[model samples]
Target: MAKPQIYDVLHREHEEVSELFHQLEEAKGAEALELFARLKQKLVPHSRAEEAVVYPRLLEESNTADTTREGIEEHKQVDKLLAELDAMTPDNEVWQAKIKVLADMVGHHVDEEEGELFPRAKQVVSDQEAEQLVDEYARERDSFVEDIRLEQRDAAE
Candidate 1:
């Protein structure tokens, strides 16, 4: 069986994050906070894995520097919004606005990746190489999750 494409995994995560964002919109107070937390949990490592492993490989192999560069800029925008969301309470109007902005930014980012980067990447990397990249991404994602958990625990104290 062919290994799953990295784009497939990332695209699925994007959909999951979108779902959590919708859940946040419908929720209030603690429930909204919980949904935001879940969104963070899903996004952080996924971003890290893409930036650390996937983007670099795509940049090198596909020679699509412009696309990768745009992706990095999008990551910065998303991270800034995420940081703002993390710092504010769900009850804050500003936080709500920021979350909406985040959803928009992420939606654009996901479209770019799925529409542009993934197709270009497939043209460059072989199935075996894609599998290897996915494997490396999984390891990095696991480590990222552990780090976030530790940070969350510390923040809870």
Candidate 2:
């Protein structure tokens, strides 16, 4: 079987996060907490993995650098929002409102990525490289996720 491409990996994560955000919107109290945790579990590591494996490669081409940089900057903004969301109590009146904003930000970012970045990346990154990066991205994301699970388990214990 053919291995997945980097676009496939990132796009799949984007869809999953979008669905999780929808679930989060309907969730309350502990459900919201659980859903938010799951969202973060996917998002943080995905951003880091993209940075580690994809962005630098895109940075190699002068033309793609700006878009690559913009994508990273967007991730930074989302991280800030995620941190703010993390700080608020689930019961806080503003929490859901702020989460809606976060969801919009993420949706816009994903649209830019899939619409522009991924297509442009095909020109910059060779087929072989894209395939290799998929595995690398997965490893980086999974390791970070495992660490998060460990931390959460320790905090609960």
Candidate 3:
């Protein structure tokens, strides 16, 4: 099957995350925890894929490099927030507020990626190259997810 464009793939992930955040906000108890876990699973790999597979191309253009650089720093902030979220229980008094902050951070990141970065990236990267990157990013993201699953499985055992 023909892979999607890089923007399409990443944009779809962004949508999923947005939905997850809404669901997370509504949930409580173990359900909230499970939803958060799922969000983390999608998030970490998605960010890593963009960093490894997409950022280099975005960085090639001076116009887009600053935007991409900021996006990378934003990703780091999200990771740090995710780690903090991971360490807290669902019922903790600060938990919901933290989730909101994470969601806001992700929302900002997605807005910039879809609005600013994707347009400039399309100008810099060819349709064929973007198509190729979709596959590479999918592979990279899948590998990261599997590695995380393995680590969790091992920890459980």
lDDT of 3 by residue, 1-157 (tens): 7658999999899999999999999999999999999998999999998899999888899879999999999999999999998899899999999999999999999999999989988888889999999889999999999988998899899
Off by over 4 Å in 1: none
Clashes of 3: 0
Name the candidate, 1 or 2, with the larger TM-score value: 2
Q: In candidate 3, which residue pairs get closer than 3 Å at backbone N, Cα or C atoms, i.e. clash?
A: none
Better of 1 and 3 by lDDT: 3
Q: What is the overall TM-score of model 1 with all chains considered together? A: 0.94
What C-alpha lDDT do the candidate models reach, one value each?
Answer: 0.85, 0.91, 0.93
Worst 10 residues of 3 by lDDT: 1-10
lDDT of 2: 0.91
Q: Model 3 Cα RMSD, Å?
A: 1.2
User: In model 1, what lDDT does residue 51 have?
Assistant: 89
Report the lDDT of model 1 for residue 101. Answer: 84
Query: How well does candidate 2 match the true structure in TM-score terms?
Result: 0.95
Expressed as tens digits, the lDDT of each residue in 33-127 for candidate 1 is: 88988898898899888889988887786456679889999888888888787788888978777877888888888888888888888888887
Models sorted by lDDT, best on top = 3, 2, 1
Report the number of backbone clashes for model 2: 0
